[model samples]
Target: MLDYAKVIVTGSPISKSNFKLFNMHGRAILPYNSGKYHDRYAIYEQEIAFCARLQNPNIVLSQSLIAVLKVFYKSEKRHPDTNNITKSIFDGIEKSGLIVNDAQITRLIIEEFYDSKNPRFELELFGESRYNMKYEICTKKILDEPKEYGPPSNKKNSYLSKKSTFANTKEAAEDSKIHCSICNKVINAENSVTANNGKMRICKDCIKKLF
Candidate 1:
């Protein structure tokens, strides 16, 4: 069973959003990559591919995976939003052929730290095979138990039905008053705007503050 695979790419990390440029041709506008960013990304991809291959030689994972990224920055001045750096790392993992696609990653964890001496990022990929085994074991244990596991009893079902009915009646009674989605404060209908075609109710005070 494969537990996890880790690869570390050593370099000053770059943000995918910061190095884009736009070009105009006639009346159309198009986005292009900066030369410096292109060169740096090429190097990053190569390093990631090399490290991943060394760790998991001749195998590519296709199972549902969890990815953990630990990023170290050179200094506080160079720190950027952690999300901005994920695109490059995910793209690199795809280009490396370590996984069939980055979309296979169902869970992601990210941590940022300052490491002036080693400004780099570490990627850890965890396969779900182990978790699946544990889940199967748990299910078998539950099945072996003496107690019966099935639907609710008639009395319990009646209680749940009554609770649901009460909730609906309460909602109908409060229909005249709108609750602000942000602050969750009850306000009169006139003071609230039905945004997104009544999907969202936001009070005027909140709208002014947010906008």
Candidate 2:
């Protein structure tokens, strides 16, 4: 079964651009994140790590990962750029110990929306094998029965209240199969050659023909 984790960080998102340049003895200059940004990032990273450990205790940090981020902004007029915001979030994920490196993220999906009342970001981490799963299905599964960590809300958010009734069940163990991209056929892992620096696989036969 594919492993996954979900986390929600409640706060105004901070952008990576909030950095200051420091000069040492007029010889070298270094960039440092603003104190406000650093503190915010620490909180976000701690929350993510806590939720990940509780949800997927056996998750392997070395495997490839996929990240789905839903960003909510209090206003659209002067919000930070999406790309800049993601940089801070990704760094938080790496520091959370959920993954050894952010480079393991093979796929990422980001959705932005306006939520003036509750400005927060929801993150879902999944194994690389989950790439083929439908977006709705993956999201619905991950968000089900969420274990919230933020402040208590007297009333649940309308968007979060609509929980899926789908039961979590293990499907056939097909996630282990490695399919060749060239011939579109299943091939043994030992007999297949990785293409595009391990982003894809190709059977020996197909590799011979192409080469």
Candidate 3:
């Protein structure tokens, strides 16, 4: 199973109030009289940049995502309900292109705490599989049978880094240039992603494989 990945957003979380709606005659409607939509839209624009190049290779669109949020307050003694902020959070993530839709998040766990020094919500999106993945465990489940886990190993996966020495196949690496480690094809250095922490370089197409 793949581990849960994290995305850190450094800002005061915008409340769901920004997405609030007014009630008409037995109907609910988004208020168009205010600039809330414009403000929220601007926020979404800035948030998408953070989601760039943040996909995991082993997991993509698992259909099962759990957003674990740690909300920190600046100076408030009593914090607002975490659920109340979920709408804005979901909208931000969807607009950020992290997930196809907010409904894709089948599971959500939100908790609030005080971090007066640094007030922001830390979000971690956990994935399971392509369609029906299971990435979480219920805390209420009985612990009488502790699940067995294997010991950690020091071995690393070098499938991508196996061609790190591609320069030997051609001219000297210094005289030549880097190539896509996965495809073994040459591409621009600026466009490539640092594979295996600089051990290898991959193009945009190959980097998508990581996710």
Candidate 4:
């Protein structure tokens, strides 16, 4: 009955208790709904078009870098503590203008794990290899999948624009008073703000001062 579901793993010996399960990277499937399954392939259709997302790309980038940093941190052993690793990764993310949260990072890691086999891929979050093609595919596949089960609708989801009616929100006015890290200048979210290291409290004009 699960049409879209693929045998992620095949040829594994199944007992009477378990059968027709797809296994990959040590994860097993219990036969979910076909549309609820990994039917993203049917939606995206094209590989290149599917791999693009603000959140997923940033996650892949962060994970890759974290891996490399872990190696060097380990080589030094006790010197670079976990805090140091986080700070270093945070700095790199800041420079690259990626604004993400710790929770988001956690989600990214978990996502990477569920769909992938390489523990190393998710573990090492700070390195060049994080940007590899394989990671890209994984992120794309995960992101493009339908958020809910059953056949996807042709209707588009309604979105509330961030810039829509800032007047309604109480904190909107005070947002302009925040200071920029690069230039130490005040900036507003609406006027010009660039987020790096998951903190958008800085202004783009001020960020330009970094150079």
Candidate 2, residue 100: Cα displacement in angstroms equals 1.5
Ranking of models by lDDT? 1, 2, 3, 4
Instruction: Assess candidate 2 and give its lDDT.
Output: 0.70
Ranking by TM-score: 1, 2, 3, 4
Over 1-211, each residue of candidate 3 has an lDDT whose tens digit, in order, gives: 4436565665566565545565666564545346666456355435633552254333334356766778887755445456777776666566555567878677777877777788777777767453233466567655586645332233333533445556455558544866787887878988888857789878998877778
lDDT (Cα atoms) of all candidates against the true structure: 0.76, 0.70, 0.62, 0.33
lDDT (tens digit, per residue) of candidate 1 on 1-211:
5567787888777876654444464443213344554455556656777777776776688888988899999986547668888887887777778888989888888888889999999888888866432212234534554744433454788878888999999989887666898899988888888878889989999999988
Model 4: how far residue 201 lies from native, Å: 75
Winner on lDDT (2 vs 4): 2
Off by over 4 Å in 3: 1-4, 18-60, 130-211
**How many times do residue backbones clash in model 1?**
0
Candidate 2: segments with Cα more than 4 A from true spot? 25-60, 130-211
How high is the lDDT of residue 165 in model 4?
A: 49
RMSD for each of the candidates: 19.7, 22.0, 25.4, 23.7
- Which scores higher on TM-score, 2 or 3? 2
Q: TM-score of predicted model 3?
A: 0.46
lDDT of 1: 0.76
Worst 10-residue lDDT window, candidate 1: 132-141
Q: Write the per-residue lDDT of candidate 4 for residues 99-196, one digit (tens) a residue.
A: 33333243222221111221111122333333432344344634564545322233223223333445447466655467765666776657565567
Q: Pick the candidate with the highest TM-score.
A: 1
